[model samples]
Structures are given as structure tokens and as C-alpha cells.
Target: MSLRVQQMLGYTLLSAAFFIGFFHRFAPATFAEPIARTFDVGSTALGGLASMQFWVYTLMQIPAGVIVDRYGIRVPASVGTALVGIGAAVLALAPSFALAMCGPALVGFGMSIVFVSVMKNNAIWFTGQRFGFITGCTLLTAAMGSIASEAPAALLLRISAWQPIFLALSVLSLILAALLASFWRPPPAEDCGQLTARNKKERTKIFGTIRSVIARPQIWLIMLAISGTNGTFYAFAGLWGTPLLVHSFGFERDTAALAMTLSLVPYGLGSLFLGQISDKLRTRKAFIIAASGASTVAWVWLVSAGSATPVVAWICFVLLGLSSSQVVASFAAVKESVPDEATGTALSLVNMGVFLTTAIVQFGYGWLVASAGTGSTITGDLYRIALWLPAAISIAGLLGALKVSETFPREQHQNQPANTQMAIRGQLQPPYRDGD
Candidate 1:
């Protein structure tokens, strides 16, 4: 088969892997209450469970990056899929809450390997210029997975038990894992050869690659932006948004779920469209600033407007979705700033920071909401209070955008010579530059 065909097939299969991987993480949103009820645990305990998952992710990020760079994605990803499958099965059979925690913890440890590995592979396969759009599309894929867990998963749970739902997921996960192991190929041998330097002075250790990311001031800024964007969204989406809507607007759970789904649908679409625009425009900062700024405004309006018409709520939700995917800028900025040698590490570091903030913010948002009381009058007030959080984080991140000096230049890397611009597994591999 042609290299392009092979690369496309590989990416498609990887995307499927991503879908299942994310489904396991976000599936908790739909199952949280049920699991808690069955186990006699509270929301706080559930948050602790989720935190354990993130902690595994935090610990695994750099190691996973190194694994991706050295072994390619196949080994780590196949292991991760098997872990997730096993974890899901264990959670399904759990007779107690403690046993259930084992399932997500194992799954989280496994996911830590898969997420960075897939993203690093994408960065290697595609050029920096396309990172924003592709990353955005990837985020959109995760969002769709989140959406499925929210409504569709709930539907399944109504007809059957959560155990059955997880069983089906495990089967799907196993099939994808097998497909990835069978078809997943890395970048071309030439590209891998390029990574090896004949002289000792020319080569840096893997730890050096990670240190390079840590040394960059701008990387932290990008992390801040991503953290704020993700933290606010995930924190609110699963726990508080439904209650806030129902309490404030008198909407039913089904209506609230539909509204939440509507809110996220735009994000998936926006990521793809905005990503393409970013690639064409060759400008990153303006998009990041505009998207975050719009989202900040939307949050403020949501706080002050009270429940108002359902139409108004839907509009605000869509705006939030559109702005959330603007995180493509964070991914694009990292790709633009880092050298190809260190790209995997840099992106994984960014992912670590983003998710760390997400896990924390998710807990904080819930605590703040509950502390304010669930009384009718308190719902809108509590929402207003909550709205400021993501806004503040986003605004701080905008300053990070100011620090990024790199831009996706109009000149195509394809115009460069074959040696400098090698094709990887049939696709063009972008040349390494520290910053430009």
C-alpha cells in the first residue's frame, strides 16, 4: 500500500484508540452517581477517585513521552489498551467501592501511557503548521466521547446495568488495541535515523529533552491557558452544570443533558474549523486571545443574566464550546516553539499541567457550588461565582500568548530539500527548529 494510505490508516486506528481511551476517563461523569449510590460513597469520595486517576497521569507523563520517542507508540499503547480493558472488567465486577477504585486507577495509569503517546505520534507524523487544527480535531474527538458518555451512556444504563455497559466498552477497547498493534506504524526509518546523531556532542539524552521544555518560560504560559480552559469546563460540565440549570431554569435532567450536549457540539466543530484557519493564517496568538476573551465575556454574561430564556442559555453554551477548542493555540504554540527532538516531551509536559489543573479545578468547582447551598436563589449566585474562575485562569493564560514569539510561517517546509524535509511513512516530516 502507499505510504500516505498507510499513514492515514494508522491515524484512523489511533483516533479510534483515542476515542475509547477518552471514553473510559469521561464515562465516570454518567456513572458517578450510580457508582456512589451502589458503594455508599459521597461526591467527595468520587472526586478523590478521579484525583487518583490524574495523579497516575501526572506521574506517567514524562515516562510515556520517553517511551513514545524510543519504542514508538505500539508497545505503550497496546499495554495501555489491555490495562484499560482489564480495569473496566475489574470495575464491572467490583462488589465494593474500594474494588471499584482499583478499576479507574488501573485505567488511569494505562491512559497516562496512551494519551501522550498518540499525541506525540501525531506531532511526528504531521507538520507544526497543522498542529493547531489537528490537535483541535483531536480535542473534538474527545469531546464527542465525553458527549457519548453523558447522554448515550445514560440511555444504556437505564436499560441495563453499568456492568454490562463497561463489558461492551472492554470488548471495543480490546478490538481497537488489536487493530493498533496490527496496523500501527511509526514515522519513516529515515526520520528515525535523523534523530540519531553520529557525534556524542550532537545528541542529547531524553532527560535533556524534558529539561529543555522545563527551561522555557513560554511553555508554562501555554500550560496556564490550557489549564484554565480545561479546568473550568470539566469541573462544571459533569457535576454542577446539570444541577445549576435544573435549579435555576426548572429544566429537567434530560433537557439539561441535551443543553450540555449542544454546548459541546460546537467545540468539536470549532476546533476543526479554527484549526484550519490557524494553519492558513499562520497566526496563533490572535486566535487564542480572541477565543479566550469571548469565552470570558460569555461566563460573565452567564453570571449576571440569571437563567433567562433557554435560548440564551443555549447561545452561551455554544460560545463556550467554540472558545474552549481555542486551546488549539496551546498545542500549536508548543509545536512551534519546541525542536522536533523534544516535541514529544514538550507536548506531554503541557498535557500534564493541563490535566493536573483540570483534576484540581473539577474538585474545587464542586466544593464551591455545594458550599453555597442548592437553594433556588443560591443557584444563580453560585453560578456567577463559579463563572469567574475559568475566566481568571483564561485571562492569565492570554498573557502567556503574549510571550510566544513563534508563528507558523507562510513558507512551506515541503519547498525545502529532501534531506532536510524528509517524508515519514509517506507523509512529509517537518524539519526541527528550536524556535522561528
Candidate 2:
């Protein structure tokens, strides 16, 4: 195959993995009652099920990054994809709560390997500009998975039951995994950076790479923003948004599913919309700050609006979704800040921060809601109080966005010949310059 065709196949398979990762993560939102009934659990217990996925995903972030960089994408990508299929099958046939919980958690472990691996592949195969666009495009695709898990999933549940849907998902994913393992070739040998054996000897010690990323002042600042903005959204939209709508607004389950779908569909579309705009503007910080700031304001309105008409609630949800596109900016910022060689570890650390915050909100927020007497009640007030946490965190995230100072760091490296600049960045820090 031509280099372009090979890279295309690689990314196509990666996108398939990304889609499954998002689908399983958000599937709990629409299936709350089924899950609770099947498992004979309460809100807090159900939240634990969702939390299990993010928590496992969070823990694997650094290790996945290291493994991708230390080994290569091929082995991990194939394994992770197949594991996700297996986990889905387990969920389909799960006979108890314990088994169902194990399913999402196992899927999460597989996903942790998938995302950073795909990102590292992007860094290896594509140029910097293409990388940013692909990042946006990647989120756009993943949001489709989230969307499927919402209203469409509710419709499917009405058709028969949730179990069979997951079973079909299992069969489809295994097929994709087989194709990825068999057909998707690596990037061209000449175009390779960290992906090839050419730079194997120039690799950083594992701890050294970890230290370098964590120690960077800018990375921490950006991560804080990502945690506040994208991280907050994951908690609210991923599992709680539908429940909040039903419990607070008096919408029927199916109606609330549609409203939630309206919200989440934009979350995907806006990534394509705003991400391209960011690319055209050649700025990450400006867009990130604006989007984070806007989303925080929307969140505040949602919490304070108090028992509005369902239409008003739907509008608020859509605004929140559109503004959540700032997440793409976070992805771009992290990718640009590091050398291509360290993209996996760097991006994975940032992902760890986001998922870590999501896990806390999933588990901790449920506990808080339960303790406050709103856990199973239909009181909007309690949900509003519970929402205060993510709103406050988003504020902190916007403040952190102000500290990230890069238009496009990776573009400069692109201008230099691969041998001279890419090699030097792998071994030593580039000359201490502005904002790096």
C-alpha cells in the first residue's frame, strides 16, 4: 500500500476503537433503570458501575502511554480492541450486578490502551496541522458513539432489551479488531519518528519521560483547565444528564433521552465546527479560554435556572454541549506542547487528569446526592446542589486556560528536518525559549 493508504487504514481502525470507548462509557446514562433493576442496586451503586469504567480508564492512562511508546501501537491496539469486544459480550450476558460492573471496567482497561495508542499513531503518521484536524475529527466521531448511547439506545431498548444490542456490538467489534490486526499497516518506514526502530536508541528512560511531562509548568496549567472543562462535562453529560432531566423537569424517560440526545449530538458536531475554527485561527489558548468560559456560564445557568420549561432546559443543554468543544482545544494544546516523540505519554497524562476528575464526580457526586436526600428523589434542587461541584471545577479550568501560551508548538518542529530537530528533542530539551 501507499504510505497515505497505510496511514489511512491505521487511523480508520483507531477511530473504530475510539467510537467503542466512548459508547461503553456513556451507555449507562440511558440504561440507568435497567441496570439498577437487573443488579438490584440503588443510585449510588449504579454510579459505582459507571465510576468503575472511568477509574480503570484513569489508572491505565500513564501505563498505556508508556507501553505504546515503549513497545508500539500494533500489539496494544489489537489487544485493546479485542478486549473491548469481549467486555461488551460479558455485559450482554451478565447475570448479576457484579458481572455487569466487571464488563464496563474491563472495557475501560482496554480503552485506556486504545486512545493513547491512536494518538501516538497520529503523531507518528500525520503532520502537525493534520494532527489537529484529525484530533477534532476524532472527537467528532467519538461523539457519535455517545449519541448512539443516548436516544437511539433508548429506542433500541424499547424494541426488545438492552442485552441483545450489546451482543451485536460485541460481534461487530471483534470483526473490526480482526481487520485492524490483519490489515492496518504502520506508517512508512521513512516517515516514522518514535514509531520506528530508527530512534529506538534515542528513547528516554520511562521515568525520565514521566518526570519531564509532570514537571512542566504549562502542562499542569493546561491540565487544570482540561479537568475543569472537559472533565466536568464527562461527569454531567456522560451519566447524569438524562437523570437530571427526568428527575428535575418531569420529562418522560424517552423525551428526556431525546433532549439529552439534542445536547450530545452538538457536543460532537461542535468539535468539527470549532476545532476547524481554532485551526484556521492558529490559536489554542484563545479558543479554549472562550469555550471553557462560556460553558461555565451555561453550567451556572443550568444549576440556578430552577424548574424551567422543558424547552428551556433543552436549550441550556444544547448550549452546554456546543461550548464543550473546547475539549478539542485541550487536545490540541497538549499535543502541540510536547515533541512528537513524547505525544503518547504527554497526551495520556492529560487524559488521566480528565478521567480522574470524571471518576470522582461519578462516585463522589452520587454519594453526595444520596446523603443529601436527592439520590432517588425527583427534586431538582438536590440535583442543582450536586451540580455546583462541576461548575466550580470548570471555573478553575478556565483560569488554567489563561496560563497555556502556545499558538502551535508542533508546527515549528515540522519545519525542521526530521533528523536534526526531532532527534534533538527526543534526547534533550530544546533551547529554553518563551512559553515552552
Candidate 3:
């Protein structure tokens, strides 16, 4: 194959894994009611079930990064995809809630590696200038999975049992894994020699890279911003949003699923748009701030309106999805903040932040609802109360966005010595050029 065709094929395989991961990530939202009915659980328990994957995914991020950095993408990607397939099957066949819980945990563990591997793959195959755009494309692909998990999954649930649907997903995941193993190839060893030599010269150990990435304040700020925005989005759209609409706003399950699908469409499109725009403008911080600010405002509008205005609620959902697209810029900023060899680690750190916040928000929202003692008849007021947590999180993220240093136009660090690069990385607020 020609080089371009090869790159496209490899990227396609990697994106397939991401698509599966995202499908599992959000499938619980559509399945929540059925699963709860099957397990005889309340909102708190259901929330725990939904959040389980994220918790496992969050904890595995660093290890996944290390594995990708050390072993390269093919092995990890194929193995992770296969594991997801198994987990899905396990969940499909589970006879007990406890066993079903194991399914998400295993799926989360497998999915934890897929994204970092894809990010590393992009870094290897694509140019730095197109990084943001490519990352956006990756997210856009994953968003299709989210979209499928909503309306399509709901529709499927209408005709078929959830078990059969998940069994089908399991089969699909296994097929994708097989394709990955058969086709995915890393760059030629000779092609990577120079980059490896550079890293060796720097004596860049994995632990040292981890420490360096962790010590950078910009990474934390980026994490906070992501946690507040995208994390909140995941908390809602991934699980609670549909239920809130169904119980609180008097939406049918199918209609609620469609609404979440609408939100996800903008999220995917907005990521692509923001990635290209940020790349063209050569800016990241401004987009981050804008997205976080918009998300906070949307949350406030949602909480205050309290299902009294369905139109307002619909607008807030769409706005929240669009604003959460800041992740395209956020991931780009994180990539730019670190060295090439540390890309996987740095990206994993930021990703961990997203899932960690998501796990907390998902469970917390459920806990609040359960605490109200409303049982199956949770009221709009109770949901409004629970929503305040995410809104507060959005405000914190907005504040963090303000402190995130600009990372575009990375020319200044290109020619610097290794020591100078390290010094620059440590600076909390690097000086910016005019127009930055």
C-alpha cells in the first residue's frame, strides 16, 4: 500500500477500538432502566454500576500510558479490544448484578489503554501541526459510538432484549480486535531510531517522565477544566441525563434518548470544528476558557429552570455538548505542553482527570437522588438539587481555564537545548507573543 493508505488503515483500526470503547462508555444510559429492573436496584446502586467503568478506567490511565509507551500500540490495542469484547459478553450473560458489575470493570480496564494508544499512534503517524485536527477527528469517530448507544440502542431495546444487543456488541468488538491484530503495524524500527536516540540521550525514564508531567501545573489546570466541562457532560449524557428527562421532564424513554443523541451530535461536530479553528487560529487557551464558561452558564440555566421550560432544557443540553468540545483544544494543549516521548503519559494524565471527575459526578448525582427518598418517583426539585454539584464543578473548571498557559506556536521550544526545554516546561506561565 502507499504510505497514505497505510496511515489511513492504521488510523481506522485504532479509531474502531475507540468507537467500541465509547459505545460501552455510554451504553449504560440507554440500558440503565432495564438493568435496574433486572437487578432490583435503586438510583444509587444504578449510579454505582454506571460509574464503575469510569472508576476502573480512571485508575488504569497511568498504567495504560506506560504500557503503550513501552510496548507500542498494536499489542495493547488488540489485547484491550479483545478484553472489551469479553467484558461485553460477560455482561450480556451475567445472571446476577454482581457479575454484571464485573463486566463494566473489565471493560473499563481494557478501554483504559485504547485511547492513549490512539493518541500515541497519532503522534507517530501525523504531523504536529495537524495534531489538534486529527485528535478532533478521533473524538468525532468516538462520538458516533456515543450516538449509537443512545437513540439506536434505545430503539434496538424496543424490539430486542438488552442482552442480545450487548452480545452483538461483543461479537463486533471481537471482530474489530481480530482486524487490529491482523493489520495494525507500528512505524519501521529504523524510522523511530532517531526519536529513540534522542530520548536515550535525555535519559528519559518512564518514572521521570511521569514526575515531570505531574509537576507541570498547566497539566493540572487542563485537567480541572476538562473535569468540569467534559467530565460533567459524561456524567449526564453517559447515565443520568436520560433518566432526569424521563422522570423529571415527563419525557418518554425513546424521546429522552433522542435528546441525548442530539446533544452528542453537536459534541462530535463541535470537536471537529473547534479543533480545526483552534489549529487555524493557533490558539488553545481562549477556546478552553470560552467552552468552560459556556458550560457553566448552561448548567446554571438548567438547574434554575428545573424542567419548567422544556425548550430551555433542550437548549442547555445542546449548549453543554458544544461547550464540552473544548476537549479537542484541551488534549492538544496537553500534547503541546509535554515532550514527544511523554505524549502518552501526559495524555493519559489529562484523560484520567476527565474520567475521575465523571465517576464522582455520576455517583454523586445518583447518591443525591437516592438520598431524597423519592424511590422511583424522583421529583424535578430533587434533580435540580443534584445538578448543583456539576454546576459548581463547571465554575471550578472555568477558573482553572483562566490559569492555563498558552501552548500554541511551539516554535520557541523547538531549538532550545534539552535543559532549556525542561526549564520551559516547568514554568507555570510562559511568556506569550503578541496575538497569543
The C-alpha lDDT values of all candidates are 0.70, 0.79, 0.85
| Residue 13 lDDT, candidate 3, scale 0-100 | 88
**Candidate 3 local Cα displacement, residue 358, angstroms:** 0.7
Q: Give the per-residue lDDT digits (tens) of candidate 3, residues 1-436.
A: 7677778999998898899899999988888889899889976677778888999999999999988877778899988998898999998899888898999998999999888989988887776678889989999999999999988888888799898988887998899889888888867656664555655554447898789889878889999998989999998999889877777777777787789899999999999889999988988999999999999999988888864766677788999999988899999898888777788889999999999999988888878887885556667788777889999999999999989888873544669776666644443444543224
Query: Residue 382 of model 3: what lDDT?
Result: 88
**What is the alpha-carbon lDDT for the whole of candidate 1?**
0.70
Superposed model 2: Cα runs more than 4 Å off: 193-199, 202-204, 374-378, 412-436
TM-score of 2: 0.92
Quote each prediction's TM-score. 0.87, 0.92, 0.92
Residue 139, model 1, lDDT? 75
Which of candidates 1 and 3 is the stronger one according to lDDT? 3
What are the runs in model 3 whose C-alpha is more than 4 Å off?
Answer: 189-193, 199-204, 374-377, 409-436
Tell how far residue 412 is off in model 1, in angstroms: 3.4
Tell how far residue 174 is off in model 2, in angstroms.
Answer: 1.7
The weakest ten consecutive residues by lDDT in model 3 span: 426-435
Q: Tell me each candidate's RMSD, in Å, in order.
A: 4.6, 2.7, 2.8
What lDDT tens digits, residue by residue, belong to model 1 across residues 1-436? 7778777887776677677766776666677778777788987798777666766776777777777666667877888877878888888889987888888788877787778767876776676666676777787787787788778888888898788888888888888788878888776766545443421232347777677679876577677666656556665564556666766656787888778777777877887888888888887767766776776676666777764776776677678777778777667777766666666677778888877766766677767767876553365567556666666766776565555555463236557666654431112433332222
